[model samples]
Target: MSDQHLLLLSILTPFAGAIGIVLLRQRPNLREAVTLLSATLVCIIVVTIFMRFDNAGLMAVDIAEPLPGLKIRFEIESLGMLFALVASMLWLITSIYAIGYMRQHKEKNQTRFYAMFAIAIGSTLGIAFAGNLITLFLWYELLTISTYPLVAHAGNKKARHGARTYLGILLGTSIGLLLLAILITYNVAGTLDFQQGGILAGKLDPAWSGLLYALFIFGIGKAAVMPFHRWLPAAMVAPTPVSALLHAVAVVKAGVFTVLKVTIYIFGTDFITSSGANDWLIWFAGATILLASLIAMIQDNLKMRLAYSTISQLSYIVLGALLATNTSLLGAALHISMHAFAKITLFFAAGAILVAAHKTDISDMGGLGRAMPITFGAFLIGSLSIIGLPPFGGMWSKWYLGMGMVETGQWLLLSVLLASSLLNIAYLLPIPARAFFGKAPDGTTHHRIKEAPPSCLVAMTITSLACVLLFFYPDPFYELAMDIGGTK
Candidate 1:
């Protein structure tokens, strides 16, 4: 009943559910029931932690001390609480969406898909709640390993290839760059525990901090900074729900979240700003934002385009972190939630199209929206949010990010953000636009195509509505984000 126990339980619940899923594999309904139940419980647990975050005076839970002064610990903070809430809440939604998708698509090894999905969620929570570098590293790698099977779920050459790239880039970056950075950090600072103002401020030299910061930046490959970003698009051979997981719920979120975490808690914004450690690195984030948006415009496959979009969207957070301003940090943190709801809705719509219309390419989707209006409608809402347009959740985050640029007098980066929004409009809005207004390739009506299964529609509806609701009521995320900067 203690908060510490609940903290531990939050990580274990999904793993425990995975075991139950395997045990009930023969009974498809029971397996799915277990998945839903587990997801629900996680939501409840994380929400409880959120409510008590300000009131109950919860203590950090130390699971082990692997080495002297190096402990595997879990602690709840405003930022972690935000990420955990997003992952937990979306896990439940994604589970509902997956039930419809896998069943309707008749995906093989359904049990394995559900099981690996649970494990991945478990790993994500581990990363979110990690109090120290060691705990985070353990969970980060687990997330990569757990999601691989899902990426290769199709068991085809493409799936296997995508999964391999996914595994290779993530592991290579973490072990080669991220782990090295952690070691260097511990060597310099004598501790890996995340702190409010950062432990490396006085310890690491300003002259060398840029190099060390680069390690952390490129090391967290999931943030998809260019040249290191191929893994994300390659992994698009995965199922749509998995794509949703990768983009919104867990994988990419973890990457940007870690970037923010390291910036705020490891490097300290003041130190980075005063030291100019992120001066050159800020461009990488900016370039990824612009270039990835350009690449997204050229992709024909909906999910592939979305994948590239994700790469671009993620850099917004990375850029926010690198900017090292409180407003920028707040924007970056809010984007974590805003982008998640909008992007997941878009992916859900993509999956719905695949299921109902058997369409993948945008060129082939013309006029199909006439038949599957709800799916396309949801897609439109999602697209607008991603574009940072009015009456959408995504606008607020972009507003703050732009303000951050103004506050810092980074006019060039401000231009990049504006240009990226134009590119987002160019790439994202057209899918739904063409679906509704453009003509089909054969010039035939899509009278036979229908909406996706009920569950899929339900999931998409909820997320799309969230996209709108968050625009009006982003207070919870906004407040928590401000808390990260000690502004609350």
Candidate 2:
């Protein structure tokens, strides 16, 4: 198939599969099989685009004309390709993990969960390949709505509360900030098409440009920058797979991708730097990176710690965008991919711990490594990756972020980055530390513990290995990111 056709399929295939699964819902095995197969298919299509994409040429398509001068369209540009790859690849891994998790826990309404997840994946694909602001906004809202069912899947008070928070923040921001930002763009730029070097760079004066930047940043709350971050941790009450979708696969990444896109496409880096419009964003992002890390350090719950870590890690990308340097932007792009593997592996391990041991507190995980070596080992690998250590994917992004700091001559940012790395270690290392080195909790009866389900272990192990593999073979992402900043 042509590239654009493949792109369209990548976005739609999941929805189509959801329909198929629903039709076969009477047979749980077949329904789940459809989910797994469809998730795999989407990943294959996304990888196809990445493998075949001409980094030199923009992958564009005008799906249809919508108005006198507006249209519905999509494209796989550099930033979009990174998001599409991460989302698509993780869908399969999360699907495998989800099947194990949901079945083992005897979760109800699983059909609806699978269907909503499929639709959510479909919407994420739309965001990744979106060619214009209109297309992205449409898919972004769709993503919000589709994930609601998953958020509320438990049909309990806590699940409902999380669903409300999840829907409220995303909907509120999109309606209040995101839509206004797009409307402003349409009026000022006269077209909402994404372009190289941005369409708003010189269109408006500094005063107006700063307001526009603010609108876009707060509008895309999925990036979870500080005040907008509560939704992420609140939404953690959902299944582990849903948390994976939020943190690694779709939701948060989409938010940051939109910010990155606006940085490069809406407000050209040169324009942003010259106008000094995004200068405040640096401190805002730095504060988030540090503050979230601090919060992570204090979280006793395993998922909560990872959630806060995701919050902090996401801001690292945002800081890179605000820095407006080639290395920083490249690091931001690479972080999207690297963090997905690392964070999802951690979450997978967390879910496994909960399932096998019925434990969530880090303090309760003492000596788990002996019984659940694979899960704990995977967690350790994931920790190394997040700590930005050698032979792990996190190192590359950290290296470039450090270089971005130096390139921009932001000495203070270097301190923030280093401190954040230490914080990453502080929170992530302890899980494995306690698992391997510490003894079981007093009177906890260590003999009763064993590894989680084989399926959970299998899925987590694969993702952890992926963390190490990406460190050695990040050329795919590196080439795409290098293409982004023209550094290569």
Q: Best by TM-score, which number?
A: 1
TM-score, per-candidate, Cα-based: 0.99, 0.98
TM-score of 2: 0.98
In model 2, residue pairs whose N, Cα or C atoms come closer than 3 Å (at least 3 residues apart or on different chains), thus clashing, are 74-131, 198-265
Cα miss at 60, model 2 (Å)? 1.9
Q: After superposition, how far is residue 131 of candidate 1 from its true place, in Å?
A: 0.4
Tens digit of lDDT per residue, candidate 1, span 1-488?
A: 98898999999999999999999999999999999999999999999988878723536989889899999999988899999999999999999999999999999999999999999999999999999888998999999999999989999998999989999999999999999999999999999999889999999999999999999999999898987999999888889999997656599999999999999999999999999999999999999999999999999999999999999999999999999899999999999999999999999999999999999999999999889999999999999999999999999999999999999999999999999999999999888888889899998988888789999999999999999999999988988899897666
Candidate 2 on 1-488: residue-level lDDT in tens? Answer: 89878988998899999999889889999999999999999989899888898877786888888777788888877778888888888889889989988898888988898998999999998998898889999999999999888888888999999889989998999999999999999888898988878888667888878778888888898988888888888888888889876656689999998899888887888999999888787888899999999999999998888999999999999988888889999999999899989999999999998888888999888988888889999999999999899999999999998899999899999999999999888888978988888887784656787888888888898899999999899988888888777676
State in Å the error of residue 193, model 1: 0.4
Give every collision pair in model 1: none
Candidate 2: residue 328 lDDT (0-100): 94
Query: Each candidate: what lDDT?
Result: 0.93, 0.88
Worst 10 residues of 2 by lDDT: 440-449
Best by lDDT: 1
